[model samples]
Target chain A: MKKTSVFGPTTALAAMVANPLAAQDAVGIDDKVNQVFADLTGPFVSLIFAPFPGTSFPWIVMWLVIAATVFTLYFGFVQFRFFKHAVQLVKGDYSDPNDAGEVSHFQALATALSGTVGLGNIAGVAVAVGIGGPGATFWMILAGLLGMASKFTECTLGVKYRNEYEDGTVSGGPMYYISKGFNELGLPGGKILAVVFSIFCILGALGGGNMFQANQAHAQISGIVGDYPGWITGIIFAAVVFAVIVGGIKSIANVTEKVVPFMGILYVGAALVILIVNYDQIGWAFGQIFAGAFTGLGVAGGMVGALIQGFKRAAFSNEAGVGSAAIAHSAVRTKEPITEGFVSLLEPLIDTVVICTMTALVIVISQQMIINPETGSYMLNEAGTAIATVDGNSGVALTSAAFASGISWFPYVLAIAVVLFAFSTMISWSYYGLKAWTYLFGESKTSELVFKVIFCVFIVIGAAASLGPVIDFSDAAIFAMAVVNIFCLYFLMKLVKTELSSYAARLDSGEIKKFTH
Target chain B: MTVKLVVGLDGTETGDRALAFAKDLASKIDASELIAIYVIEWSPFTFQTADENAKRHLRREEEIELATSRIVEPAVSALRKAGFNARGIVRHGDVAETLDKLTVENEGSQIIVGRASADGFTKRMFGSSTQNLVMHASVPVTVVG
Candidate 1:
């Protein structure tokens, strides 16, 4: 007898059995859409993600890394110097009682954190470990640390140049800073750069920020709930997203904001449990990660391969130099723009350093990577890729398998977390995309609705098919945003430094006072 | 001797009854004053999305206006017209804490609040604002049931 499952759509099952052609056609659609998207996005994706000459390293990854390194140097390692101060600011120790109505630094950080700390941590880290080998973990941490400076530089500009309307509402991001900061510096083409950034922000919102999230969520759900058409999940997600963004159902967003943090805590708790269970193997896992980072553990491309993957996944996960987080941080209620900058640095730390590391460690300690004793590296197959215990799986599936290996029921909890994370990310990105959309098209009800509808449609497309081209395009679009943003950051960074020094002088002079409650 | 009374208002009938009780108590005492306070329960730590967070300042302003004009000021005006020295205060925080703080700041001899109906399961599980004020206030609290 055929197994009955609630997750299996009865109509889809009956149709597939009654006519095998229908099943074949459904797969064909998934592939055909992927093929068409690949053709359309290929040139752009190649251009943005092009590898550096004679290396597998993508130039975009290098762009982000170099920018992070520059910011780290330019700011004199502010991420390290003021790390303690950043925590105090977030704790509201420096906040004045008079600033009660304004958005708190903690609120800004949490909003930005929700946007960055999603599938990238759960799935992106898995792909990094799966392909780049355990050694990638070291570079990932390094990138996250360096990325903190990048966040500080951009977010400071975001707050400084934010637009405050008469009604007391605000709008800010790279667009404002690029145009305004450039003008302030007497630089030409600031407006043009800002326009270019808005274009990429819209595309990225639809692709990486919306579709990629939707796609991964579907992948995790289908992995657990039995096979069903991706469109079903896509449509459901799209509908709920539409209702929240367009229908003005704030309750959903409120509920998501309340729930996602709990889910994040649950995810970390589960990871801690798994680590405790493998307590004896913790040191061994760290050794594998550190050794694999340098030696490559027989993984493809050796040490360099691990480095590229580590840097790539870390940038994708934390989104430090990408400038998306600055949009969220700009809303912070602080008289000193650098306070938001200080607070914003914590996003990469929590997202990549803390959460992504947790994911990577779990995968490493799960016994997924078989060591080749002869080579003192990971065992590889004929395909020249390290063999994973879970064959033919990557992304959240790999992470899920790792967690399930620890506690058999962790996959269910992981599935719920993935959906919530995806949903919350979409909500935050919808606002981000809407801001970009309005910046280009002007803020109007009609313009907002148009962008919201377009965003929801992409969610469906992302869910309906296996998206190789879409994923590539999404990565490209986001990197393209960095290209414009990091360039502008170079121009505006001096201004941010000026703001920082002024703030420091004021604090030293006791012009800025800390409050205790 | 002069007596000062503080009335916690929620803009509801229960609050009106509490204000009336406080008003009568003030009238009976020579050289007494009434302080009507309305607190909008709020915490900065609650999770808010970027959109909501962006508009938080505007929302806070609107809430203060609403509580002052619609709840606190109107009630205080009526008390003032009745020949009593009355002033209203609006703040954001835990209801019980804000009221207790107001009482302390105003140098009130007594605090008065309506017995709010059990709001929900959580409110019932934890005591309501009046119950909390009665338990923790620095001054004598009068529950105008």
Candidate 2:
């Protein structure tokens, strides 16, 4: 029995021999798996999500909601109380040049609006309607209205915590307010938060405010002049931007003061003409917007989806609770912070409510007139869809198409408008970015010159490179700034209240009289 | 050949110092002409009706000129008192741009300007508007802090 146990001894010997080799192979597999995982965890994640967050929910919309809610409650609805006064402020009724600032109230508002009223109104609305349908317009308008309060809160705090230079210059913005306001309130981590906000702001100004602007402007110019190359457009844009920004705030104000209103009126006038031409369809367009908002039409995932898209687009369009505008407004020449704050509220109203609505109406009416054979309904493809075969390009292209439908040679007109909007936006943003850069690096001639050069270079790069991902990340940074800024505003509401009351008392006592100029 | 001396004033401490320096130089050179220039950087008073604010702005300008005159005029008087020739001039724009224009207009004039404060970033970036005149002006420039 011991001798003939068949193959038992042989099998035992084979098993012993194969064990080491099998163990080695197993170890090799484990090592490979770990290497793959590390690669996936590192730059891969950033690359994939870097262009935009890879999430099912709209993070920007969520941030906007949180900002709106916090500011609304903290400021006690100051937007409504000061609506009339905000108009007065814009009219220069309370302008005082001796105040601790540089530019006028009107100039400050123009500067801030130049930041908010750029490609967002042009391409952002188109994106919304394309993805979410006409229903999204309703949600967008609502979000913009709420954004006014947020702007008020942030601008008020900006003035409250501004610093005065010994040479009679002034510096104030989220960088100063977040840290100083919190320090005044005895907050434990205020400085850290303030630094964090400044870092985000600087990145945002460079990416969203600066590069994005140059890119959009270059694209528009290239689109308009078939013979013109993008680099040429970028170079020229950079040169003009360099000249204006090099001169600092005074130059920026001088240029924006003239450019903003002219461009705004021109764009709005064109849209108004289109709207008037399609006057008959206006009622139906409104009906469709209202009806589609609640009971989403043939689109999949219906009402909830439509609402989400609308609010997201509106939030992106006006940048209402985003604290970026407050930085520009903070530089206004006035002792009372509330004066600038009032002017700030008009941004959302103009950018989202007026400009965005016009774009939305044009798209809606145009879509209604162009019937889709497949669905027997107005073509959604023309509005915006990922499908390449769609009737029009998304965002700016869709708006251009809408304009073309109503007027002959309209594409050229829109192309010019796009370039102007983008140009003004870039110039204004350059100042914002420069200030932030100066805040981070010391404010030396070399520092300023260096920032201006880098900024100019990015303008070229933005013109040439694909910005889908870069813009997404920039937009996110901007929203993140809003989150930090609104938090600071919430804590410092008491100071805003005190300033407002004092300003109001001055108005009542006739100490501050309206100026006719 | 008649020698001309031009001094820049903005009513700052530096400007006061520059005026005195220019007066002494004008007297030493026995110059035929002495010009004291003040550049007004746009008046906001035109936008305001308040007398106090307007006076405050005007008084500041006047004080700058008065101080400048007190330094230069006395020197001019001394030059005349000593049987020399002298004159005064004022203009407006950017300080540097105005100075360059003034220097070119009076090509043979020797320019005197205040030295910039090396204390802070603002002063450094702004650079005494006077230093700019020295760098770009066609005439010889002397900086006095």
Candidate 3:
């Protein structure tokens, strides 16, 4: 008798295993798919995440860190300066009564937040803390803070360069801005950049956005139900995703807007409850994070190791530098593109700084890190890194353990959250992937339907296999989007700055009308 | 030959003002009739299951019917009361584009709309339908204050 599935499709299959034919067949399929995935994605993942020659640091992490630091300084800390304005934009205070766009500022922000705020906050943060020690929380906070300006810069352009159709619909993203803005600037590389971006966006949509989510969801579910095949879980996940996308992106945006807030409150509420219950250890947990951030508790890379893990995982969590958020934010119905920029800064704050930190604190306070009480240091392995509670089990499993320690039933709750988070991310990414697909192929019913089907298929592929290399590749592919997107950002930052300053002046003079309910 | 004039209405008091102005102008210009189009604000943003998405077309038809009876019918009747040969129509979606399209399709020479006013917070957010007509309408547009 095995533990029954608490979350998704595999549960019933696991429970009624007296009929093992279906389950047994799925196991063979899972292994074959896993092998294929490993062979196909192995080279790509290695190339993408490869550390600098003779160094432990992966270049992609460095690429994001340097870009974030540059934007933070170059924009003069616009994230902080414009933080108040972003709040007002989200509140719909600065919106023109007659402005035309697809959705409200709040709706756009929520839609964008839904895509980035999912599994990474739950699972990615656990991995970061597990590998980099609690100190990773510190760098993650810093990375999230810097990532805000990157979000602001890209989203403002998402609206400014958006193509408005005769029907009053719009399409925007890195693809639009890269081509249109560069043409305006008389720069020659815009078309190439735009094309390159579309390619990555599609691959990323399949890998990181869809398959990674399906993989993680399958991983969590299978963990609970004593080694069941994943294809059943994959089929169910794919079916749900296809159902939503059938309504198109608006329906996706609408669902995301509602789900983002609900999940945010639910996850945060649970975190707050855990923190309150462990009120006495909250300060002590912070001390561990702060100390570990500096000392790394004898971790091999020491200070730099924690920083690298924190920044990498944080980038994954908030996806600020990645331009997918711009696609969602661009639909906002506002005359001022800068307002969307202001609103988007909040996404990273909520996703990484707040949510990721909560998970880290919970894990740290759970005593899962095995602290050296006398020296107030984490017990590290021979490799000089703190080990995960469940050996070889990282991501959501570690976080689940941390939470279940505080509340015995939390793992079940976490399983549900992971699935929901996975679903939310999948639907949102499907829209993102479809947009890119349409951009390359042209927007037609047949083309849109084609992309949607392909996306669903990948969901099945993701679910049916424990393709470690494939998930790694998709994760890298997601960051790969940042590589291309940030390149475009460098070219467009001046335009973004011009828009920001002009809007600021007009706001100062009260030229921009306000509607207060 | 009879000249045609398009009057964009919302069934609000302000929309009635635009209709009155259009009627007066039509008489001055010797236009034979007025076409009054009320544009319902419908956004593409919807959060619905796939089943709902498939049913959305039906839902939109219902909205169009509801808007015609509740909002457009009375506006048209009021125009007839004023001794104007007028036809009423109801449309949904992007306000500016739909009204603009109606003008072209109906062969209306010009469009008359009330100037957008910030009389309420709700009105403020939807924006001035008149302003949109002025900017986007295919024909010349009059924004009656």
Question: Compared with the true structure, what per-residue lDDT tens digits does model 2 show for residues A138-157?
Answer: 88887877888878877878
| Model 1 interface DockQ | 0.70
What DockQ do the predictions score, one after another? 0.70, 0.04, 0.07
Which residues of candidate 3, in runs, are more than 4 Å off?
A: A1-41, A99-102, A247-260, A381-385, A388-393, B1-70, B75-145
Fnat of candidates, each listed = 0.75, 0.00, 0.04
Q: Write out the backbone clash pairs for model 3.
A: A97-B124, A97-B127, A98-B127
Model 1 residue B101 CA deviation (Å) reads 3.4
The per-residue C-alpha lDDT of model 3 at residue B95 equals 77
The superposed Cα distance between candidate 2 and the true structure at residue A6, in angstroms, equals: 77
Give the DockQ ranking, best first. Answer: 1, 3, 2
- Which one wins by TM-score: 2 or 3? 3
Docking class of 3: incorrect
**Number of the candidate with higher lDDT, 1 or 3:** 1
lDDT of 1 by residue, B1-145 (tens): 7788999998888899999998888887754788999988876687898888878889989999999999999999999999999999888877898789878878999988989655888787987888888889999988877
TM-score of model 3 vs. true structure: 0.77
After best superposition, candidate 3 residue A247: deviation in angstroms?
5.7
Q: Candidate 3: deviation at residue A150, Å?
A: 0.6
Among all candidates shown, the one with the greatest lDDT: 1
Per residue, candidate 3 scores C-alpha lDDT tens digits across A36-84 of 8778887877887899998778888888878888888988898998888
